[model samples]
Target chain A: MTRGFPVGEFQARLARAQDKLANRELAALLLTTEPEIRYFTGFLTRFWESPSRPWFLVVPAQGKPIAVIPSIGAALMAQTWVEDIRTWRAPNPTDDGASLLSDTLNEVAGNGQIGIPSGPETYVRVPQADWQRIKAATKGDIQSDGGITATLRAVKSSAEIEKIATACDIAGRAFARVPEIASEGISLAQVFRNFQGLLLDEGADWVPYLAGGAGPDGYADVISPATERPLADGDVLMLDTGAVFDGYFCDFDRNFAVRTASATARDAQARLIDAVDRAADIARPGTTALELFHAMDRVVTGGAGGSDSGRLGHGLGMQLTEGLSLIPNDHTELQPGMVITLEPGIETGPGRMMVHEENIVITEHGCRFLSPRAGAELEVMR
Target chain B: MTRGFPVGEFQARLARAQDKLANRELAALLLTTEPEIRYFTGFLTRFWESPSRPWFLVVPAQGKPIAVIPSIGAALMAQTWVEDIRTWRAPNPTDDGASLLSDTLNEVAGNGQIGIPSGPETYVRVPQADWQRIKAATKGDIQSDGGITATLRAVKSSAEIEKIATACDIAGRAFARVPEIASEGISLAQVFRNFQGLLLDEGADWVPYLAGGAGPDGYADVISPATERPLADGDVLMLDTGAVFDGYFCDFDRNFAVRTASATARDAQARLIDAVDRAADIARPGTTALELFHAMDRVVTGGAGGSDSGRLGHGLGMQLTEGLSLIPNDHTELQPGMVITLEPGIETGPGRMMVHEENIVITEHGCRFLSPRAGAELEVMR
Candidate 1:
């Protein structure tokens, strides 16, 4: 597969952003986060792991996005469609691209509204001090982009959907190999480590997110890191991974019993997959995310709200979780290109819960699973 | 190795922060970033990869830190020493813990000044909309933490140092096995993918950052993601990684020649190691980060100045790159227990460059390399 998007893909994305800008009468969008900058310019790099320097991309009203970044990134940014790349010797105790970014904003927009993605799940990815400096120096009114950024990114292109599907396939293959590394007496931490290795071996570029739990009947919560607790007979093991393939993530999980599967655990497993199916069946264009959540909530919680985890699942793509959430309040209509995770958690006991997730894309016909669909029966590991 | 820190380690950290809070007369510190929250509470998890929910930790002047986070994190937070854990059903379209966090802050700090880290390399990790709402609702005077957060984090404890050293050791082992995964005909992207697998085998909890390049003589830049370009016989390859172990990061890189090394690349490699050695020779409790930079710069760039990576290296611990930076302007004095990476870059030829990095920790006497030190000679791949 190609490393990054084609030039036309970026051009189409920019045209879409420009359309939003024209409609809103906004001058430009000042993007600071990785996904935002990358969505417009195809400037993908793992260097964002370092919080040392802040990178900025300004999408003007009617032109290609301009990159104002650390000088270290000039070469990589040059390879992308972003031509107006401004560089600075970063960790520059004084300015650190704040002035250059503000100047670029003024030059692009000039006394108009320079929008920034400022709704939920959108952070101004700059130093708090530097953000203040950039805001003070800018001639334009720096305000929230009014969901324009989120709206543009919510829907996925065909190419983006393919990448996400490929990621799901890679994770599916990795999940198939879990029994090789997991069994009774194997520590959960080792299973997690081996599962990540399996992801790399199965064509994942990297595994960004991996969290699960193993306990009798069910696990406590889905967000905790793997502990050294060894697997035992009748204990359930959950391995959720957000493995990436070309910057796209497949967020899903698989459950297995160590040696023997309990009737209650098996039933919960069946119900979890039923929830995913229930949600996917009605997840069509014009359907709301809240409705999908209700479909899953009905199966998992028996129409009793949901687990304390809040949302059942969420929008997924460039990030493990993004865009609209599968919550009661989120009324975002499902779009043809929108990809989401149907993650439903069910309480098996007083404090034990089982959560299952699957990746799917909303299509003209209906919702189609990107991930290899899981069966109701829980596999017992040797 | 232990999964999380002991209660005493967290207690000591809280005591240190309380001292800083008392001295500054700041009512409390509102921390949003992973490292900041993890430092005081021993609450470590890779769940922060998801941007769906906001997590907050309020460090009051006295008493245990209060955690105002999503209900999903309640179980994990309970595992830590933190007692006052407040939860909100997150993705709550109206308020994702904004009111709860502000209320917690007000209860802890009263109407006094609440601090948030605002200096260089410090970002307010909350979403922009939620941050504004929290600021608007808080009765306390919200402002920059002055430098209290940075000051407290710069100096590490014995346990923190040990974890960092362990991470360095894991990376060192992974680097040693590069020959097993890399060779003249293999693509750089494959090498990157395999190297991450090696890191997991070498005992890293996760490989968060891995960026490198392979080109004839030397790579153009160090921050670019690996391309599909195959490594040629005359290529010089560098693999930089920020591998984590128990939440501590070891930020370092190693250089390798594919089959054979060019004289220019060999010389650059030698100079980079010499620069690291020079920096370590004077990196003691009394030495400043500026002095260390000058030492390394004298050897790498002959005092002509460093590359665009900004600083040659910076402080390292809970995060990949954090706290003080090694630049001419940074005058922060080194203290015992301060972990840092001594990285130096040089122009091998016109547009080509090479960089080498080694993790080190300042001691009462001098700097000691935490990462298994690389020799002056570049290892040629088979």
Candidate 2:
């Protein structure tokens, strides 16, 4: 309805990438990754296909960025902010694309060091041939540099936060409508359809992700909807949805009792919700991501009677799970404008898991909740 | 729902991949691409985030394949035919996933030539860094053989053909329901939800792709679904859906005129349907893919008054648009058991395009329409 989010959002991301390149003293930052490319160039060229020839968004230390894409997708890229679009036709060697990309990098960087995020941990796109091509093209030394982009994307802008909040609202509303649209004899596909319908009605720009399972025990790994699994009495329905609004995403889920509630399920839901609440209470800009994990973990393990459900939750925005997770190894400090999700649950056993997820945007002081609905157990019947 | 087609269906695919490796004279094939990985190992890993860490399924020259995936996804891989499963925990670098993958590829191929479809034409899943690690670990040369896997995948097995045919049936039925469900008042998203619901109800393992658009001129690109556009009078509704069943996909589309149908739309639809009919008639075993292209092209262009719609159709199976296409350059010979789509359409003006798509399997003597429903004129509504 409303034209997709203002193009200004993409411009801001490009500017941020430029700033990162400047700060790193790198002449150019080559993005051989899909997410990085999507972040810099507001083009969705990486569809359902082979990404072996990693497309690049070459950010110069001081200048406009350039987009290197497949030749056929050039027309679509023309609609984006990256004015200079390079296209390589199919059946060509990655070496060909690499040579062109390398030439661009060499021209942009001159004698300065080129920042290439070709390290194992961060690089999953560039093939060996292309890597060799890039190496040959750059006159300067190449260094693995993913930190530049990661640091820029770690913080969310006001507009980005808004999109994330909107996504959370849509997901929450969809979850709430599940009970109204689903019944005891309903199949998982019906429930999925109902949720998808609500998502569309509410103006979800895209169904970024929809995965869930229904049973007496809550679903652990959310999956695509199917008709085989039917909701029955006392079935614990776990819905984990990642609906996108204007490219920004929010990951959230809700626990619903299909018929009469089970004492075990109800207890697990209450403890997990309360634990997440306590964790949120302690969440502040000064706290560390790991500390938040400990806070939420303590509640679920102690209150849920020795239930283990991994890390309670992680960062959410732009990505389903982004930088600075509520996991033990995450040492990043929470800052204002950083959006994240705090989800704590108990996976009682196989096919049985109770988890509640909520979106929170860190503020100058504590944090602000973006979820439209409060944390409470839900019950539905035919 | 019926349990998905037997595991034997997937085993046959692995067997085919092994045959490809032997013919190509490669010791083993390094599958870094998602579609090929799923085809060989039946392991479905969501590419929602950075799939940098390679999930390798090594099909040795002479034995069952082994998989090395992230420890978190080990259980999922075990549920498939992969005999050996190795997992490495996340967030580790030196002794992490890259090292594990490097070790595995080295052991599998060892001093022998390793087939790596790492090219500009190949879809990339391995990150630039992991690819470097693989290069470092391999004792022998990394051969860039692109079409080996595609050649095997292009030909469909009996089970694969059945799955594709079943998907076509589901898609056709969904389109049939559109006559009753779609109206001038419904939003594009609502129509999409209904289409997906019908497919899921008919028993789909997953409806991974559902995309369409509402425009005066027929919508050509089927990207993300933007459900905000409501159907209106004189509007042409274009529905292009790619339904995935048991990992195999069938991509097809149908056009309908919202409200009363116009003479231009009627004329265009009739010509496009005729072109498809003629194309199907000419499709025969031993015929080159280009012959089918010319047949469809002559009918559509010669009949629709000359507007090149680019592609007439392409091969369909595990991937949405697999192997060769009905495009000019494709010269692959049509063989029995290979299923393809005949999609011929024309867009004369904005809100005015008529395109028809249907699946056809190359038989021993000639082609058989896999999609049972015949092409029809645009549906008119008051």
DockQ of 2: 0.28
Error of 2 at A146 (Å): 2.8
The whole-model C-alpha lDDT of candidate 1 against the native structure comes to 0.89
- lDDT, candidate 2, B1-382, per-residue tens: 2334568877777677677777778888877666777777666534334332456667788777778766546656777777798776553444446677767777888888888765433544654566666688778677765567767777887877888888888788877778776898888767776666666556555465665666664664445334557889877787777776666777788788898777777777788777787777778887887777778778767633233334577777866666665766667799988888887767657524466788889898888887764545677755
Q: What DockQ class does candidate 2 belong to?
A: acceptable
Write down the TM-score of model 2's second chain: 0.90
Which candidate has the highest DockQ of all?
1
- C-alpha TM-scores of all predictions: 0.99, 0.86
Could you give candidate 2's per-residue lDDT for residues A1-382 as a string of tens digits?
Answer: 2434467877777677777777778888877665677777666532434332346778887767788765545655676767888776532431446677777877888889878665433553665555666777679878867677767777887877887888888777777677777778888766765676567556565564666677785664543234456789988877677777767787877778887777888778777777778878878888997788778777777633223223466676766776665666668898888888887767656745667788898888898988764545655454
Predictions' DockQ, in order? 0.81, 0.28
Interface RMSD of each: 1.0, 4.9
> Which residue pairs collide in model 1, if any?
none
- Per-residue lDDT tens digits for candidate 1, residues B177-291, read 9999999889998999999999999888899999888998888888777878888998998999999998889999999999999898898888988988888888999899999
Clash counts for the predictions, in order:
0, 16
How high is the CA lDDT of each candidate model? 0.89, 0.69
